[model samples]
Target chain A: MRESDKDIIRSLKIFSDVDERLFETLVTAAYAQRFPAQVDLIHEGESADFLYIVLEGCVELFASSHGRETSMAIVSPVSTFVLAATVKDAPYLMSARTVDPSKLLLIPSQNVRDVFDQDPAFARAIVTELATCYRSVVKSMKNLKLRTAIERVGNYILRLHDKSGKADIVELPFGKRNLASILGMTPENLSRAFGALQSHGILMDGARIEIIDRAALETVSKPNPLIDDFRS
Target chain B: MRESDKDIIRSLKIFSDVDERLFETLVTAAYAQRFPAQVDLIHEGESADFLYIVLEGCVELFASSHGRETSMAIVSPVSTFVLAATVKDAPYLMSARTVDPSKLLLIPSQNVRDVFDQDPAFARAIVTELATCYRSVVKSMKNLKLRTAIERVGNYILRLHDKSGKADIVELPFGKRNLASILGMTPENLSRAFGALQSHGILMDGARIEIIDRAALETVSKPNPLIDDFRS
Candidate 1:
């Protein structure tokens, strides 16, 4: 195994406590590849043949119905995608594509299942990882079903601001178009939602966002830790 | 162990392959209780102490934001809620309440974790269970984000119809108000969505629904199996 690849695998919290022997088996079966920007890594409904770990660059996980695609999540470097589908050997529910030229490690689904069965530590880690992923999606559902588009935008900015350690101005990580879909809104609606937040003390200049009146925004946004806090 | 409790535990696909001794440990720690209709079993943000398994009746799992609550899911008999939270000892993301008088088995979180660590069979079962749950929520997110409210209503009805076998007429399992919240809409909007579906050949009388024109509803719904199929 490549030293760099081994390092990446070791870095993931899921593999942190696994036996070195089992980890060696995992690393032996895994192979890394690079993809250009906007390349579809996996399509919805395709048999989940492999679990892709983003080694570098971002991947957008989205689902489409009636030709309209809504972004579900953005998997960043050093994280895995479609783990549940891969574990169960089920068809992918969401399509994944790179936002920029990316390097990813692909491990066969069968290997994942086999390793999971052989190593109790690996299995335990998978339980924790899958549980976290499940709760995260549940949080997303609550965010979608409980809040309006503008509220979503407001809380999202607040979360970013919080993550940046109280930076008054925070830059959007991805493009507005993708963020709109991630927030479950149309591009036009996203524009209008940002306009609505302006009344709540936000000033958007290109990718940079300035929270002019945090107090006022909090009144409108009502960011709850259960819904807004990602780290938990 | 009660014969009934052991029977229920054995029936769950998650526990089907586990050793009988471990199943006895689970059953010993589990205690069943009955609740009146509209009882709140667990609230969001509370530390998850126990995992609740529904033996009978239904539970509505919902989240509240800024004083407005939206139902996230309806858990029926033989299923579990807040499993991820219980497994990780994390705060519940969604509050669970009985939609009707319900019977539930409560298993201490610590016991669950202990058994999980000691029994590889149990750990594997949890892996499969958690993976199934993660995929289920992903499917829900896709339903909420990728489809409109009316389309959600349409597909939901289609799903209920599908679950009921070839029956053209189906009765809603819960009240319309709760169903409205579950579908992420105001009661009025739900009514409007139902009215909109009337044009697509759906007839609703109280809780009973008849799909007069399956093809028309399917066309309007555009129910792709990737987004709408529940059994997969």
Candidate 2:
């Protein structure tokens, strides 16, 4: 097996636990593709052709409304993104783009369907993946409906800190503009929100954010399912 | 098989086309249970134990939001409802109730899992079912985000006309309030939306509605991949 192909399987949670022989079959069927930074692997209205397994770097999941894009999720290393479109072979609800120079495994949507047919475990994994996707969307809807801009940004920074193993400082995944869209706020609103959080001592930072006071932020936000967890 | 069960299966799109043996298996596995109007078939937050095939009358799918009831969908006769939750074995996201004296095929969720494990065709059926469910939700979201209350109600009526195969008239499965909730608008808003449409030639008489001018309604509210033409 090619080294890059091994990296592909290793990066995907759904395939990581499967035997090497099965991985080889999957790798044989898949083509390792490099997407340049900002390249779109999928578009909102296009028919789904493949399922992406991110080997390196990150990808953005976003929807466009009235000619503006809203970032829905950020797919990082070792994650199977867009399983819903792949399994259903339906047109994508959002577009996917590389946030960095990324290596991805392009498995034919048919291969995914065939695999699920033959492997119940694979079906179960895909089900879990889809369930997670649904829950994340539900969380997003709740966040859009319930939280204020400053509260959303503060909770988002806390999430990044938690994701980084409680590091004091963590770099933002995308620029403040993209992060604002993800939080369903305007760029100006996001800037103001960040400033407010910093003033309140809930968070602090330049490009890298520091969680100066987690307890205070959590108390204010009340950290519902959306703000408290990404997987939910 | 009981005559009523046979008639119900004949009406459903999924079971109507399958071979007799498969249909018989599905029908036999399902036990007919009756509930009085307003009785809960499945309660929100409870473990989802059964997949219901509504054979007689209507079921309203709803969840409580800040002490207010928000409807998810209306399940009509000869259609399977809550298949997604049943297959996942997740707690019910929405409560279901009989809007009238309802006879339903209560297939244990466990039976669904067992059947899917052994039958590839049945598994394919499930994939189709779930895929349809996902698409329906996506369409609803699009409608909610893109359309006004007036346009939403307009498209919904057109959708009903398409589903019931009635060019002139279609019956409301649930009341105006539940329909309003499903469309993500208020009852008063739905009433006004209907009134606005009536002034524009979309006809309504009590619980029955008639699209006197289909082209005008479609012109006012363009339904794209709309939640119309659904079969159980």
Candidate 3:
């Protein structure tokens, strides 16, 4: 790995507190690779051989069952995916694929477990990371269970609006199909939901969504921090 | 706390490996209380003051929005809940209630955090516990997204059947109303689904169900270990 890449990995929250020598050991055992867009990186039900950290571009974590597939999460740069599976020595619950040409660091799962056992800081960090992940999924469950598709889409748009610096227009991060899967809606349902949101004062022009009236939209979305806040 | 209660708490997976002194400290700061059925234990937006371990009976983790409530998980004896919220010092993302007259041990969130920081064993256990929780939620999300309501009910029956030692008779752990919420369906829909399952070789009588033909039921459920296996 390049010194620059080691520096980037070192800055990650999960690794930042590890002992320097152990961190060095981890990075030495790790390797980075680049993959083209739409390439399947891992498949569900496979043994988790490595813990993946995306250094650049985007990766989609998804799952399939009985001839059906759904998007589970979208991982962007500087974040790790599949840590739980790695730590537990369990099979990957979801498959991962690149949405854009991406670079990722693959740390052998055995090394991660070994380091985690030896390094208290790393163990604590893993605890925090996993707890955050658990809470996020719980929130997502609430979003899925408590809200209707239109409400989910409305709240999602409000989240984007806030993330884009309260800008009047916000771009969809990925394709509508992925967004539909993320929101637990069919593509046709998503389109219809977007149409329904127009009555609440938003305009969708392909991927670029214009928030004509933020207040009107919030009245409909009623985005709650317990469900919508990612940072917490 | 009673000595017996402490023994129960000590044997819990999250606390099993902690230093004896630390375990005593945690239990010293903890207290056990009994709640009647239908009592709310914690609200969704409330700060997580304590981590709870169910000792007897059952607790239902649930969430609500737009005046609609959904059951998240049903917690039984000798397992912890809200560990993610306690570890993160975040508000509870879901409300919890006793599904039956229940007893629970409550450890102050601060003490849990302090113990977690001081005891590497405890930290490691917490990591393992949280990772398990995260994976379970991911599985649930997949179950929700990839399957229809009837399929979910069918798979749920198969799970209960296996849990009952392959007995032809299996009892629903909770009432139809709560089961419906847990399955992400209305009670009416759950009834309809159960009615539909009768044609697939199962008979439902209130909370009691008889699996007349396991093979036929499995055919409809197509119970995939990737989605149905909780032990992993």
Candidate 4:
């Protein structure tokens, strides 16, 4: 890996408190690779071999059952995916694929466990990261169980709007089919949800959504912090 | 706490690796209490103050939004709940309530963090626990998003049957209403799902389910280990 790439990995919260020598050892043991768009990164039920860090582009973590598949989460740049599986030395619960041409750092799971055993700081960081990941999934499960498809879509838009500094126009990060799957809706239902939202405050032009009335959207979405706040 | 209770807590996988002196500090900081059935232990959005260990009976971990409620999980005896929230010093994402008269141990969250920082063994245990928890939720999300209500109900029954040593008769651990919510279905739909399953070689007597033909039940359920295997 490039020195610049090593610097970026070192700066991540999970590695920020690590001893410099150990951090170098970790980076030295890892390798970086780039993949084209829509390339499969890992498959569910396979033993987690490497802990993946997305350095560029996007990755979608998804799972399938009985021939039906659904998107679980989208991993953006400068973060890790499947760390839990890597930590537990367990099978990957979800499959991951690139949404666009992506670069990733692959650290051997054994190396990670070895470092974690030797470094108290890294172990603490792992606990924090895993806790955050666990809570995020709990929130997602609550959203799925407690909200309707339209409500889920509306709140998802609100989240994007907030992430974009409350912009008037926000672009969908991925395709509608993927979004529908992420929000636990069918493509047709997602289209109808967008149609239903038009009467509230938003105007959808293909993937670009114009938030004409933020208040109206919030009222309809009823975004709860427990469910929608990613940072908390 | 009784000596027997302390022994039980020490025997838990999360506590098994801790230094004996530090383990004593943890138990010394914790206190046990008994609560009546239907008691609410923690509320969503409240800062996590204690790491709760269920000593007796059952606790239901649930969440609500927009006046709609759903059951997320059921914690039975001799296990911890909300460890992630406690570790992160974050708000509880789900409310927990006692399903029956119960006994519990409440360890101050600060104590957990302090011990976690000082003890490498404890930290490693926390990682394993949190990783297992994170994977469990991911599996649940897959189940919810990828399967129909009928499929979920059937698969849930299969899991129960497996847990009961493949007994011909398996009883639901909790109420049907709780089961319905946990399975992400309305009571009406759950009833219909059970009704639909009769043709698949199962008979329901109140909460007691008799799997008259295990093969037929498995055929309809199509139980995937990725979704149904708790140990995995």
Name model 3 segments beyond 4 Å from true: none
Candidate 3 clash pair list: none
RMSD of each: 1.6, 4.4, 1.2, 1.1
Q: Taking the tens digit of each residue's C-alpha lDDT, what string does model 2 give over A1-232?
A: 4785677465566875655666566777888787889997888768778888788888988765444356777788767676777777777776789988998878888888887777665676666566555545544544544456676777787788788998877888777777877787778988888877776554546678777777876665556442357643
Error of 3 at B190 (Å): 0.7
- Top-down DockQ ranking: 4, 3, 1, 2
Q: What TM-score does candidate 4 get on C-alpha atoms?
A: 0.98
Question: In order, what DockQ does each candidate have?
Answer: 0.80, 0.23, 0.81, 0.86
lDDT by residue (B106-159, candidate 1, tens digit) is 988888888888777778777777787788788888877778899999999999
Off by over 4 Å in 2: A7-11, A16-23, A63-73, A142-172, A183-201, A204-223, A226-232, B1-30, B65-69, B77-89, B164-166, B196-216, B226-232
Output the worst ten-in-a-row residue range by lDDT, candidate 4 chain A: A124-133
Second chain TM-score per prediction?
0.95, 0.83, 0.97, 0.97
Per-prediction backbone clash count: 0, 1, 0, 0
lDDT of 4: 0.90
Model 3, B1-232: lDDT tens digits are 8998888787788888899999989999999999999998999989999999899999999998878889998999867899999988999998999999999999999999998888878887877878887888898888898988999999999999889999989999889999998889999999999999999989988889999998888888878898899798
Please name the candidate that would achieve the greatest DockQ relative to the true structure. Answer: 4
Provide fnat values for all models in the order shown: 0.87, 0.05, 0.82, 0.89
**Candidate with more favorable, higher TM-score: 2 or 3:** 3
> Which docking category, incorrect, acceptable, medium or high, applies to candidate 2?
incorrect
